[model samples]
Target chain A: MSRHRARRSGLLRAVLSLGLLVGVGVSGTMAYWTDQATVTTGQLAAGRLDLTLNGQLAGPGGSTTDTTFAVGDLVPGESFARAISVGNAGTVPLDYTAVSHTNGTLGPGLRWTVVAGGAASNAGSSANGDRTGTCTGGTTTFSSASAISANAAAPTPVVPARRPLAAGASETLCVIVRLDPSAPSSLQGATATATFVVNGVQRGAP
Target chain B: MSRLRVVVLNAGALLGVLCVLVAAALWVTGSRPLVVQSDSMAPEIHAGDLLLARSIPAADLEVGDVVSVVDGSGVRVTHRIIEVSESGAERIVRLRGDANAVADPDAYTLSRAERVTWVLPGVGSAAAFVDSTPGRVTAIGIVAGCWLAVVLPRRRAPLHARPRRRRGIAPVLVGAALLLPAVLPGARAWAIFDDTATVATAPLAAHRVVAQGQPQCRNEGGLFGVGEYVRLTWPHVDVRYEYRWEARHTATGEVVRSGVVQPAGGRPGELELRSSVLDLGLGATTYDVVVHARLRAAPSWEAAGTTTQVRTSAVLLGLGVRCA
Candidate 1:
């Protein structure tokens, strides 16, 4: 019985030793697994949207700076036109529109037309010695022959349709203004001026 | 022989060998251990966390799978796939950080992508340091030295000559050192990708129009019954103009004559006015003459030239009338 007891004690001791060693190994593995180091992933940044007219970006409320047009010496039965550049200067695509407002008595006799993909060219004077011009190489999008208000505070839509402009893309608009031949003779030698503003916003929901 | 001591020694050695073999297997499989570095994928994943990543075919990737891709600059970015599409034979993947509001600006085209297989929280820093060249070299040198201390002494010294305490601890130390490089060297470069797009300020635009006209007049005719006329001229004017004349009796404040000259066929800026013969009943009569002109054009202007200086001296009956 004593011999059997001695053998049993030895086996128990071996098992205890193995368990202790296994416990130590597990603890070490846990420590290594829990080991940490500092690392960084590159920063994630947000995108921006910019719409420009003639390479000029728009400010808040769809306003821009240092851009204006001046046309003069207009007469009855004559028309004048010019090309305005519209560009998308941002990284993302955008949609835009144009509006105009005129002041002075001559405004009532003036008619406006807008066409895309056109070039403004002076067509020389007519037989009656009146100034004349044309918008060549274009498709007319909007035109109105009826007289507008003499002094309109509210802006009139030059291009009622809103179109999407791809990033870094540019479009030229041929804007034409004509004086009615039937305008009353009392409107001579007067002046009329107008302002054109183009507004743009980021691309719509995808 | 004390069985306790022998058992302890064998168990330690066995544990050491297992650690070394496991480390070797991980290295041959090309598995990477990556450390999280940004909060772009927060909540589910966090900074300072360690991940075990495995290589997968690009075609096998699906939307919402977290992946790590190397860009042209050799920078590796880990993000979640928001979209997966095929372009010809190429695979295109669009990714975004979980914490970001928008997807990345540029899509990734790849043949293979790394997908995370396991995550060990808060073990990234240690693994990164150990995996680095300096850290790895230093650690390997220490481990090698420790291994030599244990093995060399055993080979040289007789089995009974070695110290009992030293034999019991040496294998455990060797085991831990071998495990160092296995867990720490999985990641080389990991970063969070950005999706930023900025817009510049817009400028102002406007247009203006104008028209101008000037007119002048002259009186060449005199006397009450002889030639009485006024000529109007406007220079540098292209549009047509209308003129009117009125003859008033200055003493009686009565308008005796008034006529409107409609836009007549003439030179663009010239007008001639002739008056009817006046009746003189043996008395001298004085009259005021006034002329007004205007043009029909855009934003028209009024042009009036007043000529109220006509007088009659002595007049006999019938057709005998003289004036100055």
Candidate 2:
């Protein structure tokens, strides 16, 4: 009788092991049940988010390559405007703002303004000409005219109306820089060059 | 043969159990293993580093903490907090990547933020791959393979077979391994949730300064006779600068006239010099009048002085100005 009992116990242990193995196998496919079909939404993959500024004036929908620009040779009451093409080169959408840095004695008298999706009049060229320009139509996203101290301290948003530039989309940024008409004449013949940096971040809440 | 079968079964069981437990624990804790894709945060947290972040109340957050926030487009960004402002029940947080030059352009208003609690450098790439479709398929295949390997072999031998003490420890080891990452979040809760501070900078842009006009030449009465007077006007001038004008006979190379003029009352801005030129002694000879001005406190990168020169010949009686 004891021999029979031991044999039964051995058989029971084998069955339990087999059940555990089957359970593991069944678990893999158990995510689906009867009368159900998998509608694959799509494969999952990681994406990148990036912002690019093309100072080359490469035209609308400009090259997504990165570059820089310099606003030079300005006189009081004169302004210079450049159409910088800002592009979203990454797979994810992003919004961007512009910050200006001035270096030289003439820096104090210079004013920066950025307009998005607008027409620039008498836009200044790199070569010496009339150094005055203005933006019309679109939106005046930032103007250092009224709040010089407060404006200089904070970054100015370019696309306030239709922000969060979609991926693969590019927009023309009319960067208008003018020397204050009231600037003292002492700032003349002295150079104050500027660098405009476009800072981008993932789109924020609506 | 039976000994070999037992070993394979035990090994397969160990692997299968580990995979399930670890995967389940990750899901239960709501932990996401993200692979950083940019070098915006460097040195301490770099691109390709695997980050495990846990959620915390926004009100509990303070400045200087590294957190992950979701943007409107559903993108997760990891950055350090530079500012935190409270508006009623809402918290507005400004963030900047450790490696970025400026704070992020947009601020986040949230009730909760996912603060990074763990970092495993250089492991993000592998984790990213494993999270992909092909990688998940491969993992499932591996688990299924282990299950099959453990279950296939059957032994019909003696009854009351005792399990080895060494074999019993495998489950314990697997349990511990799976529990480490899960338990760490709670065990070192304070260390993982601590906040860190950061700084920001604001800069202004300027336009270029160009010259619209230059110095000119005119005739003026001198001590000796009718002399050539040169007027030099500069757009930029400092209070401490002094302007000097000198004329030399081009033919004989002799210094004709030289004098210094001080700025009026230590004033800054447009400075001018009006000086009469002395005759070249040689009748009707051409001479060059040059103005040199120096700034006492000019910066090291700038030229200490500026020079302007104009060439002219005597016109109205030997000292008359006639620029050619």
The sequence of per-residue lDDT tens digits that candidate 2 reaches over residues B1-324 is 556544444444444444445445545775545556555666587655667666788898889888877666544667889999997777899987775556665799989887777787666554444444454454445444444544554455566767433334346346546533321111111000101111111222333232222454433444444454544555434343445556676666677777665657544233222223455443445655555553322211122334344454445554545443
Q: Among all windows of ten consecutive residues in candidate 1 chain B, which has the lowest summed lDDT?
A: B200-209
Question: Candidate 1 on A85-142: residue-level lDDT in tens?
Answer: 8777766676666666666667777788878768887676543436566888867776
Tell me each candidate's i-RMS in Å.
14.5, 12.6
Best by TM-score: 2
- The candidate that wins on lDDT is 1
> Candidate 1 lDDT, tens digit per residue, B1-324?
233334444443443344344345445665556666655566577666777677888888889888877665555667889999997666799987785434654689988888877777766665555445554454444344333333332223355654533233345546545544333444533444222221221211111222223335466565554554555555423334455556667677577777655553544445454443443423556666555654444323345455544554443212321222
lDDT of 2 at B148: 52
Whole-model lDDT, model 1: 0.54
Residue A196 of model 2, lDDT score: 53
After superposing candidate 2 on the true structure, give the runs of residues whose Cα lies further than 4 Å from its correct spot. Answer: A1-96, A101-152, A155-193, A201-206, B1-12, B20-38, B57-59, B71-74, B86-91, B109-112, B122-147, B150-324
For A145-194, candidate 2 gives per-residue lDDT tens digits of: 63233233553443444455788898777777676766664664555445
**Clashing residue pairs for model 2:** A72-B208, A73-B208, A74-B208, A74-B209, A79-A132, A100-B204, A100-B205, A186-B269, B64-B196, B64-B197
